[model samples]
Target chain A: MNRYTDEERQLDELLRSASPRRTVPPGLDTRIMARIAAHERRRRERRAIRSMALTCLALSAVLAVVGGIAVRSLDVVHRPETLVLLLAGMGCMALTVGGDRIGEIMRRL
Target chain B: MEQPTDNEIVQRVAAGDTEAFGIVVARYSEPIYHLVAGILRNEARAEEVTQETFVRAYEHLDRFRGGCSLSTWLYRIAYNRAVDSCRRRRFFGLLPAHETLPEPDDRPRYDDETIDRMRRALGRLAPRERALIALFYEEERPIAEVAAITGLSPANVKVKLHRTRQLLRKYMETQ
Candidate 1:
């Protein structure tokens, strides 16, 4: 243990003299910040696209249900898939609201 | 007013204040660069890896729960980035394993020539060993901090550090 201590001291001294602490080059912070800003922009764009898609899906689901109800009232169709339209609308609503949570889960994966 | 702490800076960044992250970059860029350069032995590559580390930290700022100090967290990220870069280089055969030099039976000296030998010896060490030396000696971090950066237990850090010290001594003392 004493020998280890002695060696450790010598090694520490040698490394200190040989490899002094380096200074970061000028503009490194700027370069890093630029990259970070670009990444943030890309992430925001992706989220916007996701939100738009979800909203479209929900709106389309709503239109399908309204059309089904109108057709049922018209009494022209023998069978109206009102139940399926309601289930689709509910699923799309959940997806639109829970999009962020789903994103977090996917990122973890 | 007194300077806000690292947690404060992290919180500000997480709160959508993008400019606040520049403070984190300015504060840790130097030591993180030094640690990465020591591990990589390449200044340009170290700079690139340092930038990547900060970007990664920024991206995950919301996930930082402050279980450890900001410096420790940054050091851990920097260390991992450096190691991953090394692995990728090795995988593509871009970096060759450093060859060991023959030993001589003379007392070690700390001259310029000896410094050159020390550098070569450092290059011969594994990336993880270099990281241990950088955090413990160059950065002057405690054993616990070193363990945190390397994801090793404190006892494991001590044992690995002891063996690395001996290996470095032997390599530098060689002809």
Candidate 2:
């Protein structure tokens, strides 16, 4: 049969009573919530910047494509070099705007 | 109203409901503070580390995979932060070495004076030993959970708990 020792029981009671439930300072929650709010704000700002950059890049690409098609259909000039340059510019813009996200996606895949 | 589970609260926080994290903070702050304070033996430093622990939990909410209860995960973070703070303090000679207590006959009872003395004796233990005693005896955490929080094996935790109890007993017996 298991037995209880005087020392063990005393130690248990001592530890339990000694380690009282500490009262968190009233301002701690406010401070933590404020920090969380600040973190969220920074995250939102980063997302906003990324989205704005992506939108501008997309608009530019679409405009370039439409203009290229229009020029070709109107027979204004057979500028293959201009079309190639536009495509290259769009590629660079995509890389610049979404390079990190694209890399992350690819890494995940 | 039935309170949400920790996973639900974590989901809300992960979904950008930053205020939802307050629920987690309210639930854990006291215990986390006590745990940190027990190890650091400095209320100010322990409070700071507890705050940092919550902030870290918020930042890493998405990475929580529900592998363990949120309390366990939170305790683990608090434990690590307290240990780090203790090490930094020791590095600067800020933490004093464990003091040798004068042995008294018989174990001390838990009167007000004895309790105060016990608190002092606890402070005289090594930081990790204090942490082990706090988690095991005061917190009443399961051995597995304590092991997970402290990164010790279950068997090792049991052995350490035994030794820490003996040390505490010795300290408490001191005048």
Candidate 3:
């Protein structure tokens, strides 16, 4: 029986044996690639959803800004109309930011 | 063209060149195998989990950002699956259900039967504890990476790893 602790030595041997460069079963490469392909497909789907969200946010920003600006010109209540437009602009920015944050989180897949 | 780097391979895989992913898998299979096998202590189960690791990684490949190292991401999947399998086995009473259990790797071989006694002693440690040793020694991961892979905070990992090492060292001594 090996009586001494030699724990440190044993550890070194263990580490060396387990190094990532060790040979694996043949054709594991193929299996892994097949797996990655499936994963990428899912990832692409998520990207599409995120793109859709971004598109909605952009359209909403333009509509809100243009409508708010045109309303201010016609109403003649410059202060209130201006304030509303600025608030709408801020809201659009926030919506875009929120969607971006969520998109980043979802991208974690 | 120059041989593609790991990052390049990953990016290509991300770009939907599925074959490039073979490089990634071939790169890590051996280590991942040892990681899961060492933790689960069942060669067959380890192989199953290792295969599942790739399957799960594939299922969620789109969400993988390059923030953390790719190896770290793969280790995280391996660790989580090992933990889940242990929990499921426990809950299902697939094991003793009542008898006191040993550490994972129910049948570790010892050299010339001299270390066979020590093998049983080592098996007394918990799966997570055993996992720490395997990660540190077999995976050659730094403490910080082990913390990330195991989902323990660095400080906590340090404490657990230190304590686990001491236990193994001491256990080996007495045997």
Candidate 4:
């Protein structure tokens, strides 16, 4: 064997150990799993609410169209030459986007 | 009776028994951790990377083809996560994500003879180079396995492994 220093071998021996590995705390798994479960619950609720909102908005849109048509038919019966009510309905439709000045933001978004 | 295979756990996880995935985490976390720690070197960040690996694995399990072993797939995820964590550490101007070895007299266990010196030397290598050495020395992967895990061809792995060793040797000698 090549000449070996005692101190060097001792140091090499000392440095050659590996620490025992510990797992991430068990609670970490529970917390993460719990969060995933809760997130799924929240996601379903959010999707349901979004679908309901879309349905309500669609119903409102259909009602607006039908009411405008009904008013136009009335205008024809009462004062056939007048564009007043139809023009008013057109203005109402222009303001169709309804939640707190949403029309202005919708143009940008 | 057969104990559950990783593929079985994975299939259950995909079928919506999210809690069933904890078994997968519990089983693989240590190997996944050592692999991450080997590459990134910070114990705390390695723990975070291990956790994120499972999270990403869960998120992407549907895309996992059964052609490869589960651990191989997880290694791929862990590797990508470690790389991202390394980038984040660098971008934040933090010290590279590596653990400080205790003094030889102080640390009870160290597998690398020059643990501290090697770590300091490792810093000089590019991340991919460091990763290759780590997969060899730390993860104990053979060149073939390392190539499979890192997606390098065996020939490329050998070439890269040679350069990696030379770079570390240079660092050790110079340092």
The runs of at least 3 residues in candidate 2 whose Cα sits more than 4 Å from the true structure, single-residue gaps closed, are A1-4, A49-109, B96-109, B172-175
Q: What is the per-residue lDDT of model 4 for residues B62-161, given as tens digits with 9 covering 90 to 100?
A: 9998877888888878887887778777788886444553233345455455666656777666667767766766566777777777888999997886
DockQ score of the complex predicted as candidate 1: 0.34
- Give the i-RMS of model 3 in Å: 7.1
Over A6-109, each residue of candidate 1 has an lDDT whose tens digit, in order, gives 65676677777777546577899899999999998988878876766676666667766776675566543543465556557666766677666566546744
Q: Candidate order by TM-score, highest to lowest?
A: 1, 2, 4, 3
Model 4 ranges off by over 4 Å: A1-28, A31-35, A38-46, A61-109, B96-99, B102-113
Query: What DockQ does candidate 3 have relative to the true complex?
Result: 0.15
The reply for model 1, stretches above 4 Å from the true place, is A1-8, A75-109, B96-109
Task: List candidate 3 segments past 4 Å from native.
Answer: A1-27, A31-109, B96-111, B169-175
- Between the candidate structures 2 and 3, which one is better when assessed by lDDT? 2
TM-scores for all candidates: the values are 0.79, 0.71, 0.59, 0.68
lDDT of 1: 0.81
Ranking by lDDT: 1, 2, 3, 4
RMSD to native for every prediction?
A: 7.5, 7.5, 10.3, 7.0
Best by TM-score: 1
Give the alpha carbon lDDT tens digit for every residue of A3-93 in model 4: 5567545433432333224344456566555555676686566666666567557757876787667665674456643456655665576
i-RMS for every candidate (Å) is 6.9, 6.6, 7.1, 5.2
Taking chain B only, the TM-score of every model is: 0.89, 0.84, 0.81, 0.85
Give me the overall lDDT of model 3: 0.69
